[model samples]
Target: MKHTKVKDLLNSTKPVDDVLVKGWVRTFRNNQFIALNDGSIIHNIQCVVDFENTPADTLKRITTGAAVAIKGDLVESKGAGQKYEVQVKNLEILGDSDAEKFPMQPKKHSLEFLRENAHLRVRTNVFGAVMRVRSVLSFAIHQYFQEKGFVYVNTPIITGSDAEGAGEMFQVTSFPLNNAPLNEEGNIDYKQDFFGKETNLTVSGQLEAETFAMALGQVYTFGPTFRAENSNTSRHLAEFWMVEPEVAFNDLDANMDLAEDFIQYVIKYTLDKCEDDLKFLDQRLTDEEKQKPQAERSEMSLLNKLQFVLENNFKRVSYTEAIDILKNSKPNKNKKFNYIIEEWGADLQSEHERYLVEKHFKSPVILFDYPANIKAFYMRLNDDNKTVRAMDILFPGIGEIVGGSQREERLDVLQQKITELGIDEKELWWYLDTRRFGTAVHSGFGLGFERLVLFVTGMTNIRDVIPFPRTPQNAEF
Candidate 1:
């Protein structure tokens, strides 16, 4: 008989006889009821067995985590929890799970413990829902970009130049470390290496995406990115995915509009498609928060927060204006901030960002026109010659979800900035060609995909939202 997925079975309009179902057993209660899940949805379908007529050996095999196929009659459930259930007439244990050996039993486990057993953690309700939401969010991103006639470009994973200029990058090489060939200056020789030059995993696809955008008009790149920062904080990851969209002939205002619309569309899409998962996560967050102090709890529920963002416009503020607010704010006045706001060129910390979004504005905020020295070299310089046309979208909980800018199009100014920053002119000659030949105002932004998932799912730690988190001192499967 053909097997029916649990999701379809649960949503069936009418009862049917002799339906076949296959899934892993979640729990077996009273030797009669079997809870099964197949990853189609977070909810499990109840399978009731006829214990009186079934053999003891076959019944014992229906343990948690065991795979089974049951031939049964679908009827209205008598239980108050679910709408329908399967009355099993025949049961076969395709795979057995020893009750004593299985790590995930029918009980609550700590998230830390689950992180250790990352391979099997998805079988749980929380991880299952989080992953489903993550998948839907990813699809929504592509759908939004495609609907707007944007071309999707695949950027290279390995590159010879650093995009962010942070110098925290993982080097890609095929040379043996112990006996590496040395050059005349006693440096590692790259002539015999795979790429014949030093290369590393790309930190961002914005640089490559720009080249395509110049030709294609508008393009977006969604792929994995890497960094070698040793911060072991909950929000930091050694490797993660980023979504970058580059558009030709766009300025700072148009770039802000694009980012705001893109984010709201994706959030709305997830809310519409992943209703069940979102509801489960909402309750999970509420229950988890009950254990903490009232001051530590979130101001709004998960659904309410998402709706608020869609309904309200993100507050736009200038970097100089934000500096004045922080300098006069109560936190800075009371000496509560770790880094006090004393001057104009000081970088804003997470505490300051949260104060703006969660306390002062009570909505998402976009801060633009950052200091030129602090921002990337490619951002367009302002008339003041001190600030650049950079913008960062700050969410309520997540500090900075999107970072973007209007790129410099003047060849002379760009080349001067590149020289001042000490970036190799020869290495970036191809990039410079775009400005030299046909210069046009262009803009784009890069979003941390996992951070979006973390906000939507109401997960506090960024690590929990992504599967197989790569952090410092930890790279387990």
Candidate 2:
């Protein structure tokens, strides 16, 4: 007989008389009862069997974590303490799982322990749930952009220039890491490397994606990106995924609309599909918070806040206003802040960002028109000359979930800014050529995919949600 999924069986009203089921054993009891889960649902169903009636060796062979096929009769089992139960008539061992050596067991394990066994960690309930949610989120991203007529652009993983303008980038080459290359100035010579000049793992695909958007009118790139920053924090990963969407003839407002809608769409999709997973995370969050001081509780109930943000409109504010709020804020009872957000000059820190969103705004807020000095050179210079048409979406717990801006489309302005910023114009020749051909106003943003996943899944550490996370000192799989 063909096997029926546990989920389908749960949903069906018809009596599950004489059914066939096959799955790995989650837990086994008294050599007769076993809990089976094939990841069809978050919760595993308990299967009851009569050990006296079955073959002794067959019962002995059926161990925990082993795959088994059961020819069973499913009855309305109320006394077995399960909503529905399967009583086995005959059992066949498909494969044996080494119960004593398998990394995952019924016992609760720490995240650190799970990280050590990253390859097999997906067997755990938390990881299994997260991977499913991650899968759905990827699909939701494609569906949202595709439905809006946005062309999906596959950007190169290896690039000549760093898109983030950050100096951290991993060198890629066929030669040894230390002895491969050298220049006359006693510097690591890229001339001997694969690209002949220099190339590194792409920090972001925004620039390349912009080229496609200019030609296609609207486009997006979703792929893995690498950064070699030595900082090893819970939030930073050496290798992570990024989503960048560019649109031609779109301004800051249009870009913000896309960001908000994209976020809401993903949140709604997860809630609709992974209700059980979200509930599990919610329980986990509650327990974690309970151990902390009562006053230090998270402001928004993670799950409730997600639903609220998905349904409500996001607030929009200018960088200047955010500064004013920060300045007016009562002097810190603790040490003075390193960078005081004075009227119009400094970059906003994570603490300042959280204050604005959690205290003043009480919701997700888009802080726009940041000071030109702090923003990227490609941002459009406003009439004031001090600020640029840039925006950063700041959420309560996580700061700067999205960063975007209206590109400096004017050739003269872009060229002058590039020169003034001491950037190599030759490196951006192809980009400048886009301006020479047909320059239309354009805007886009880079969403840190891991950060977004952290927000939606209520997972504290970014490493927890990602499979085989790569950090500074740890790349073990």
Best by lDDT: 1
TM agreement with the true structure for every prediction? 0.99, 0.94
- Which pairs in model 1 have colliding backbones? none
lDDT of each residue in 1-477, candidate 1, tens digit only: 689999999999999899999999999999999999999999999999999999999988889999999999999999989999999999999999999989998899999999999999999999999999999999999999999999999999999988898899999999998988999999999988999999999999998899888999999999999999999888989999999999999999999999999999999999999999999999998899899899888888889889978988999999999999999999999999999999899999888998999899999999999999999988999999999999999988778899999999899999999999999998888889998777899999999999999999999888898999999999998
Runs in model 1 deviating more than 4 A are none
Query: Can you write out model 2's per-residue Cα lDDT over 328-438, one digit (the tens) per residue?
Result: 875323335556655568778888888877777788899999989888878899989889999998887888888999988999988998898788999889888888999
Query: Which regions of candidate 2 fall more than 4 Å away from where they truly are?
Result: 79-82, 181-189, 331-343
lDDT of each: 0.94, 0.84
User: All predictions: root-mean-square deviation over Cα?
Assistant: 1.0, 2.1
Q: Residue 209 of model 1: what lDDT?
A: 90
Give candidate 2's root-mean-square deviation (CA, Å): 2.1
**Once model 2 is optimally superposed onto the true structure by TM-score, how far is the C-alpha of residue 79 displaced, in angstroms?**
4.4
